[model samples]
Target: MLKSLQNIFRIAELRQRILFTLMMLAVYRVGCHVPTPGVNGQVLASFFEGTQGTLLGMVSAFTGGALQRMTVFALGIMPYISASIILQLLTVVFEPVQRLSKEGEQGRKVITRWTRYGTVLLSVVQGAGIAVGLQSMNVAGDPVVPNQGIGFVILTVFTLTAGTAFIMWIGEQITERGIGNGISLIIFAGIIANMPSAIVNTIRLLRTGAMPPVTMIFILVLMVLVIMAIVFMERAQRRVPIHYAKRVVGMRNLGGQSSHLPLKINMSGVIPPIFASSIIMFPATVANFVHVEWVQKLAGMMTPSHWLYNVFFVAFIVFFCYFYTAVTFNPVDVAENVKNQGGYIPGVRPGKATSDYLDVVLSRLTFAGAIYVSVVCVLPTMLIGQLNVPFYFGGTSLLIVVGVGMDTASQIESHLISRSYEGFMRGASIKGRRG
Candidate 1:
């Protein structure tokens, strides 16, 4: 492992990419401390402290506590993520988007342009909502927004929108010139930034007798086990064997090769959990702003520990697992491409039969993947509620951290292997091919 770390810096390009990513992430972290104008930072933090079990807590987690601090980056990259999910759904239902998606690089560029526009629109709306919401909130009669008016609202909106836009730009730049999926890395960095504090809090809990030493050990063991499960599941795949028929090309035999398509056990990656969480949190977030008995009741029922919340959360995760899988993978298209390359599944005939076979396999895999995702996400909630852990230790955060770590490490290994250098593992390396 130490050698691999040294090897990464041995390559100039990879080193630069890693350094650039670090620099951009540092910029983001610095921005997280820059508070938005007109907000009482101490009061806002106190309010969020009381909201650790609410949707606001979840949002703050994604933003690295920026929301708790009422920073300019309190909005974080969520608007961009929401915009992306919206555009993806639109591509499925809208003909123009679907057409543009099929148009290759140029078409993708057009769609990207539209997504950027959507991101800006979402930032504006969410920014305005947050600005308005802050004016109404108070921590022990101390207003979160001290001086509230049109000017404050406009300034707040502008600061938040601009912060989100800047974050979106950083993500794009990281993707182009740095490493990994820039958006995912940003979220990863945010979640990880709080780890040291969480660790210290856990230690303090132990010393204060709030949590028994045995319980802390159990939590640590459980975390390790869960992380291991995630690593195994993320790397698991169903390999469909493909055989290329022998062909005569200019009196020379060609095309006699065999390969297998690797369909990931979790084809949708972390999208389902993210999408499900966003859907489940929307109502709770609105409820925080609205002052009504019924709305408060609904919000209470939707708290992280509530049975209704878990039921809906699991359902949404499953629904999105299948939905996102369908959006990303097309059996008919894969079958067509395979046929064009003179390859066929061993037992399945070409054309419709092949497509049908692929679809059935994918459907089964997606169902299993949904079950895995639900278990991973819900188990942490159960643990936290029952054990009263001091900080967010698992669930969606764990999944994203492990998933992105695996992907980034795999990419690094690929670069080393391509350069004829030994990967982290001796004589073995992480595989990149997946269908």
Candidate 2:
């Protein structure tokens, strides 16, 4: 492991890329501390203290506690993420987008441009809403925004929208010139940045006898088990064997080879949980700010600890697991590609039959993956409701952290192997998401 760390810096390009990524992430974290103009940070923090199970808390987590601070980056990268998800959905339903998606690099650039546009638009709306919401919010008799007016609203809208756009640009730069998927890394960085504070709080509770030692032991054990499960599931794959037909080209025999298509159990990766959480939290988020009787009641029932919320959360996870898998991986295309290359699944016909076989295999894998993700994610809420475990130790956060770590390590290993250096895992390699 130490040698691998040394080898990373031995390659100048890889070292530079990593350093650059770190520098960009640091810049983002710095922005998270720079508060918006008018809001009282302490009061905002106090308000968030009581919002632990609400949408505000979830948003704050994703933003590295920026929302609680009312920082410039309070909106975070969520608007951009939401826009990207919207665009992905559009690719399936909109014919023009479908055509554009098939056009390769140029098409993707177009889609990305549109996604950015949508991000800016969303940031503006969300920022304005937040500004107005702040005006209405108070800790006791003290307003969150003491000097509230139209001026504050416009300024906040501009500040937050610009912050999100800047974050979007940073992610793109990191992806183009640094390592890993930059957006994932940004979220990973945000979640990780909060770990120290959570640890400190946990220790405070332990020292004050608010949390029993046995409870702490159980939390540690559960975390370890959950992490191990996630690692195993993320690495699991169902490899379908394929054989290339023997063919003669001139005087030489060619094209007699065997390979297996690696179909991952969680082909959808961490997307289902993210989408499910966002959708489930939307109404609750609105209810948190708006105090209508029905809205308040609805939010109460959909709290993270509520049975109704868990039921809906699990259902959404299962639904999105299948939906996202279908969107991203088309069995028909894979079968066609295989057939064009003179390859066939051992027990299946080339074309449609092979497609059907792959589809069946994928459906089963997706179902299992969905169940695994739902169980992991829902477990935290069960603990929270029954045992009062902190939300900081959520399964979704761990999933993203572990998944992103694996992906980054996989990319790093590829670079190492390409340069004839040993990877972190001796005599082995981590399979990337594509595999």
Candidate 3:
């Protein structure tokens, strides 16, 4: 491992990319501490202290506590993620988006441009909502927003929108010139930034006898096991054997090759949990700003500790697992492409039969994957309820952390191999969940 770490710097390009990515991440972390104008960050933080297991707490986790601190980066990359998801969903129902999606690189550029526009629109709306929400928030008589007016709202909207736009740009730059998926890495960084504090708090609890040593050991063991399960499930794949028949070309004989199409056990990656979390949290978040009796009751039921919340979260995870997988992977298209390339699965006929077979296999895989993801995501809530620990120790955050870590390692391994150096694991190569 030490040699592999040294080997990374041996290649100049890889070294530069790693350094550049670190610099960009540093910028993001610095921005997270720069408070937004006209807000009392200390008071806001105090208010957030009581909001654990609520929607605001969830958003704060993804923002690296920026939202709690009322920092410039409070908006984070959620607006961009929401925009991308919206555009992706539109491709399934909207003909124009579908047509553009099929247009290759130029089409992707157009879609990307539109996604940026959508991100800005979402940022404006969300920032305005947050500003308005802050006006109403107070701890014992101290308002989170000192001077509340239309002017403050407008300024906040602009500041947050700009902050999100800058983050999007940084992510794009990292993707183009650095390593790994830039947006995922940004999120990984955010989720991991609070780890030290969480650890300190845990130790404090242990030292103060607030938490039993046995419970601490159990939590550590559970985390290790859960992380192992995630790594295993993410790397697991269903290989579909494809046999290419011998074919006569114009002048030379070709074809006659065998290869396997590796379909991931979890083709949707972390999208299911993310989508489910956002959908489930939306009502509670809206309720936070609205001071209605019934609305408050509804939000109360939506808390993470509620059984109904877990049920709905699991159901949504399963639904999105299939929905996103179907949208991203088409059995009919795969069959068509395979037929065109003279490839056929053994014992399966070429046309609809092949598509049906693949679909059946994919359906089973999706079911299992959904179950695995649902279990992992819901476990944290159950553990939190049982142990009364911090919400920062969540399954979704760990999943993202592990997934992003694997992806970054895979990219680094690719660079090492391309340069004739050994990878981190020597003969073993890292494979991320996405691929």
Candidate 4:
């Protein structure tokens, strides 16, 4: 491990990328400390500290404690993600977006441009809502904001929107010049940045008898088991065989090859849990700030302890797994591409039959994926509800962390392969002893 660490710095390009990503992440963490205008940070912190085990706490954890601090980045990248999801759904429903979605590179650029615009618009609205919500929050019955006027609201909105935009820009820069998927890496950094503090907090709880030491050990063991399970499942896939018939071209034969199309069991990646959480939490988040009786009731029904919450949460994960997988990976298109390239799944016809074959395989994979997601996410809810444990290492958090880590590692490995350099695991082979 030490040798590998040293060797990373030996590669100048990789070292530069690593440093650039770190510098960008440091900039983000600094922004998380810059308090939003017209708010008492200490009072807000006290309020969040009181609600440590709630849904808000979980969201705040993803934001690297920014929400707890009520910082400029309190909103994090959620609005952009929500806007991106909305746009994808729009592509399914709207004619123009649907057409644009199929237009190849230029079309994708157009859609990405629209996504950026939508992100800003949503950020404005969400930032404004957050501003109003903070103004209404009275910590310990003392209003955190002295004057809840237009000035405070507008300033808060501008500050937070700009913060998100800044974050977005940093992510783009990292992707262009640094390494990995920049936005995801930023989020991964945010979640990881809080690990040391979470560990200390868990220890403090043990010391105070709020949580037993055995509980802490159990949490550690559970985390390792969960990570191992995730890695295994994430890597699992069904490789469907494809064969190309030998073709004649200008007195030469071409197009005969054998390959397999890798269809992942979890084709939707970490999207299902994210979509499920946002949808389930919408009402609860609203109820946190408002006094509407029906809304409050609806929200209460979805609280982690409620039977409705667990059932619907699992159902949503399942539903979105299929939904998102369909949106992102289209069987009809894949079949068309395969046919265009003179390739066909052996024993399957090249057009409609091939599409049907893929649809069936994808459906099975998606079902298993959904079950895996449901099982992983449900365990944390059960632990929190039944055992009253503060296992902040929830399935969603683990999914995001592990998924992003795997993706980034894959990209790094590809980089190594492209440059003819040995991979990250080259010298540290698991199946053999090091020299």
Across 1-435, the per-residue lDDT of candidate 2 in tens digits comes to 899899989998999999999999999999999999998888888888887655567668878988889888988888888888889889989999989999999999999999999999989988887888889888889999989899999999999999999999999999999999899898888889888988898899999999999998988888888899999999999999999998888988888899999999999988888878777765576567776888888888887777898899999999989989998899999999999989999989999999999999999999999999999988865785577755565888888899999999999989888877443556886788683
User: Which tens-of-lDDT digit does each residue in 48-99 have in candidate 4?
Assistant: 7756556777678778888888898987877777777888888888999999
Cα deviation at 163, candidate 4, in Å, is 1.3
The C-alpha stretches of model 1 lying farther than 4 A from their native spots are: 421-435
Q: State the TM-score for model 3.
A: 0.93
Across residues 1-435, which tens digit of lDDT does each residue of candidate 3 receive? 899889899889999999999999999999999889999878887888988766678778888988888788888988888888789889989999999999999999999999999999989988888888889888899988889999999999999999999999999999999998888888888889988998998899889998999988988888898899999999999999999989987977898999999999999988888778767765567678777899878888887777888889999999989999998899999999999999999999998999999999999999999999998988865786667786566788888888789889999998888777444556886788794
RMSD of each: 5.0, 5.3, 5.6, 5.8
Which one wins by TM-score: 2 or 4? 2
TM-score of 2: 0.94
Query: What is the lDDT for 36 in model 1?
Result: 90
